[model samples]
Target chain A: AQSVTQPDIHITVSEGASLELRCNYSYGATPYLFWYVQSPGQGLQLLLKYFSGDTLVQGIKGFEAEFKRSQSSFNLRKPSVHWSDAAEYFCAVGAVAGYALNFGKGTSLLVTP
Target chain B: NAGVTQTPKFRVLKTGQSMTLLCAQDMNHEYMYWYRQDPGMGLRLIHYSVGEGTTAKGEVPDGYNVSRLKKQNFLLGLESAAPSQTSVYFCATAEQGRNQPQHFGDGTRLSIL
Candidate 1:
């Protein structure tokens, strides 16, 4: 069984500040990792994903995540935060050829001016 | 392309009542999934289909039943509603292969009184 853990339940950052959200996964083999964001009352939108390539993967909305096998982590990072970047973010892991995804408990980001 | 669309964006059901949620995709995807999102609980997969006429249980499938009779449609049914089942349900679709990203619907907010 695969599982994901997000250490932070809520985070607050000021505009123009750097931000990083931690994500860790427990899986047997090389896992497919993904980041998703959800606004209030809306469905989740895919931010980025890491399959098997460069350690650093860029995503939409000026976000990126680096996969670190040694740390079992795929933390999402942004150079500077914007007010509109506030949302609930989730990290997920899935097995190869598997149709299901195991998701973390999510981290709610709050960007303040 | 309308991507993925779910019907009845909001619904309120009483305990013991039954309801079905419909999901349609225009992306010609071969895989579709049903997931529920609760506060701090990211998204948990309830059921999924690899293709038409095939359904499989996901991480959380106890109170949900699913069917995929058509390649572009997936239906999630709640036999008997419960307060514990009040959450946001999202439907998503993806192509058949590794590293493919899943497209999500706007989600249906369901509340059981």
Candidate 2:
């Protein structure tokens, strides 16, 4: 079975500050990883995804994540966050040939002014 | 394009009541999924379909049933609503490849008393 773990439940960062959200997964083989963001009362939006690529992947809204296979992690990072970045973020793991994904408990990001 | 759209953006139901949630996608994707989001539980996959008429149970499928009668639509049904089922439901669609990121709908907020 595949599982994802997001260590941070809530994080507060000031505008223009760097941010990093930790995510770890347990999967037998090379996993398809994704990062998604959701605003209050809205559905999730894809931030980024990693299948078989370079270690680092860039995403929308000035976000990026690095896939560290040895650590079983795919942490999302941003050089600077804006006020509009306040939202919940999730990490998910999928099989190489599967229809569903297993998601971790999300991290709530609060962008402070 | 609408990408993905979920019907009845919000609904409230009493315990034992039944209702169906509709998910439609305009992306012409072959894969669709249903998930429920609760506080501290991110999004748990309830059911998924790889193609029309091919439904499969996901991580948490206990109280949900799903159907994919058309390639562009997936429906999730709650036969008997319960308080535990009060949460936001999301529908997502993706292209045929596992590497493709799933696009999500705005979500349906369903509350059961």
Model 1: what is its DockQ?
0.74
Off by over 4 Å in 2: none
Superposition TM-score, candidate 1 onto the true structure: 0.97
lDDT of each: 0.91, 0.91
Instruction: List TM-score per model, in order.
Output: 0.97, 0.96
- The residue-by-residue lDDT of candidate 1 on B11-93, one tens digit each, is 99999999999999999999999999888778888889999999988878998999999999999999999999999999999
Per-prediction CA RMSD (Å): 1.1, 1.2
Chain B: TM-scores of all predictions? 0.98, 0.98
Tens digits of per-residue lDDT for model 2 on B1-113?
77899998999999999999999999999999998988898898888899999998887899899999999999999999989999999999988887788889999999999
- Give the CAPRI rating of model 1: medium
Best TM-score among the predictions, by candidate number: 1
Is model 2 an incorrect, acceptable, medium or high docking prediction?
Answer: medium
Over 4 Å off, model 1: none
Worst 10 residues of 1 chain B by lDDT: B94-103
